[model samples]
Target: MTTQPPHASGANGAAIDLQHVTIAYHRRVVCDDISLSVAAGSFTVLVGANGCGKSTLLKAVAGTVPVAAGTVTVEGRPRRAWGRRELARRVGLLPQSNVAPEGILVRDLVARGRHPYRSALQRWSRADDSAVDEALAATGLTAVADEAVDRLSGGQRQRAWLAMLLAQRSEIMLLDEPTTYLDIAHQHELLELLGRLHAEGRTIVAVLHDLNQAARYASDVLVVAGGRVVAAGRPAEVLTAQVVEEAFGVRCRVGTDPVSGTPVFFTESVPGAGG
Candidate 1:
């Protein structure tokens, strides 16, 4: 039985809205009739077990994946109403892995973010240079602007990708499993950077496997299970021990982080959790 999660709303109004949205891959359903809202400037994290469609949902919002039914509304407009370049200017997506062209300089890679602003006959302008420069500086890559992207450290490479998004000046950023290959320290570094971006008033939606990390960084959490959102709210409200067990099938105890005062948990078993 699917327990309907309440409609998510942002205090500043929605940046993205999904109305009875259903998504499928190769004619097989992934997410079903989901209604959710991503509030403007909110840092919302999607947490779920493997293959639960969190990434697919992000792609739908980015217009990379088509919904089998229903609608996706972005910035108060139906998704299909916007032109490709226009939508690219508004929403940016960073997938799980990015491969820079062989020996491509960091500056060159970040410069590509300005593609949406270009046309068949347009030449590179000072404004494009300014955006790329500002993005490199903001992401702490100015010193390495001339370095090849493949030469950067894991954290730096991720930041390089993020700089591309920043250069796009996108209002809504959808990141799928951004922390996948980073070490503990680098993970903190990237998450902190995202925190700063959210503080600057850009909307952030990410798919993360670490519920604890999600709890610490997210302004709101959505627990996805069995192709549906089972819970949605603040970390303190929705990431309870019972919710964790139900979504992940792990026995755990929920606690508060001494530093951030966010919800934290400890697993006790590898098998079933009491329902």
Candidate 2:
């Protein structure tokens, strides 16, 4: 049975909501009293320095980590109330690192996303096949659908993983540093693709290390520090120089991006600073 709080409706019809959530490992609290929400069809970015509980928070939202206190809800339904397959069909998660099975074809790797939709008696259906094909095409991997996942380049591999998530066709996507380990061009490409996905009415919430990139693509920014949300608002309103310095412990200047008018950060090296 699920325990639901009264008055749980979220702002702007949020797809995911974390209410006073606290997570601990070995009795040491990692995240404390964290509360946030991801609105439907919105692009929300989680930004913080290393070891600030960004990844842990995302894991909690994905149901991969147990919360020590508080509740997580999807469309006002408690996470524990949803079965594994049901949750998989509504929410998809992409971790920072994924190990592809050796010699698995790209198409087969993506097909794993359909597991939630299948049963022991019912095999792949026409809709499943079409979802796979559309996912491959959306990620520009239709040509390499037959290639070995291990043989693909880093950028291609990232796209393949994205294709897998796309095949799930979930309304909410929780991504952990999806642009990690990619070149600058690929990073931009991946973020742009996420922007397009948001425009198409998918709710996207991601933990990103690149503040400038987050500002460029995210409609809302959640700035975290010391396991607490320091600011959450429009990119221009939440990503000030003061927030950057406080969160990152670095001197920086925040400016608007010439192309997008989003907030951008530039670090300054003090004179006589030594590594």
Candidate 3:
């Protein structure tokens, strides 16, 4: 059995910290001996091939998946040490997929984010209402506030779900493929919204599959491969040709994007490689 040592808080401070953590389902290990620290107020993006354990690591940090070893902390405190409600108030997770109840109105769905703030005997307060409204406006969902979530387009639904997380009012945002299944325009829109949220001082950690998008938006990039971190640092430093080829098993050219000036990848062509 692998044992994790006591977790020491980051000297620079962190919003989410994982120390020598391992995640497994049954006996199949997913992520092994991983140590990661997301600095407060950072726009950190996780990038890797599918099934590389990036999403699993994110879930582990969100406390949705139990860690087989090591500790995950929020604001320097063990995640499990915080009460459920307290934890919910500190970290909000926007899963890749969220299925709301049938015919659930958007505002009502977003209002559920305030569950941690309300007890059985307590009614909704003015603060709750304010948070919900603010989240709706922030995500530009006020236009569809009355529509059922099931009736909205994919991008709108994603924004609605994001609104709920915002209403939760957590300091750290853990999003898994939040822009998945959306068209290019919608994807950019959602990323812009996240950028705005980060600008407001929320610590954002997201798993993004698009390497270009990850480099374009991320203040920090973590590249995962074979269930471990292959590279982690600033996008420019981490998304090198060597790291990209090592992680993705493809040769690629890494250069500055003409538009954003961030690193962009161009796959090296192999003649007759494709059957």
Candidate 4:
């Protein structure tokens, strides 16, 4: 059984909402009393130091990790209230790493993402096939769709995983370090793909380690420090020098991106180090 209030696909309401959410593993709290709302169609990035609970908070929103306290909702309904398939249809998550079966073909791996829409009685439909094909094409893997996933280069493999997420066709996407092992070119490619998706109005919430990249692409930035939100707002407002230093314990100078006019910063361990 499932109750639907509003679809997560628009700019109407919060795509994902965490209200005083606390997440812990084995009684060790990672995020405590964290409250934030990801507006629908917003490209939001979570930034912080390693082990600062950015991924933990994202997992909580995705319902992958159990929330120790408070509530998490997608489209104004409690996460637990949604059926598993319903939840999958509403939100998709891409973790930092995913290991596919060594011999599995890229197309087959991407087909797995459509499982949420299938059941015992219902089999593969043209819609599902089309979705898989579209996802592959969108990720530039159409030519290599039949190739073994393990044989692909790191960037190709990352695109394969992303193709699977695209095949899921969820309105809200939660990504944990989506650019993990890619080279600079691949990273920019992936970011451009994300930009296209955001333009199509899917909510994108990602955990990113690159402050300048996040500022360039994200509509909103959330700075997490010591398991709590230190700042949240537009890139210019949230990615200031003080906030960056507070979240990462690093000195930085903020500047505008020449092309995008977004806030870009250069970090320094010592004063005038970049000079």
Where model 1 places Cα greater than 4 Å from the true spot, the runs are 1-12, 272-275
Per residue, candidate 1 scores C-alpha lDDT tens digits across 1-275 of: 11112323334389898889999989899999998888887899999999988999999988999999999998888899989999998889998888989999999999989998999899999989988998898788999999999999988899899889888877788999998777998889889988887887778999999988999999999999988999998999999988898899888998889999998889889684365
Which candidate number maximizes TM-score? 4
lDDT of 2 by residue, 141-166 (tens): 99999999999998899889989998
TM match of model 1 to true structure: 0.92
C-alpha TM-scores of all predictions = 0.92, 0.93, 0.93, 0.94
Q: What residue pairs are clashing in model 2?
A: none
Cα distance off (Å), candidate 2, residue 93: 0.2
For candidate 3, the per-residue lDDT at 267 reads 90
Error of 3 at 235 (Å): 0.2
Lowest lDDT block of 10, candidate 2: 1-10
lDDT of 4 by residue, 134-170 (tens): 9999899999999999999988999999999999998
Candidate 1: residue 65 lDDT (0-100) = 92
Off by over 4 Å in 2: 1-12, 270-275
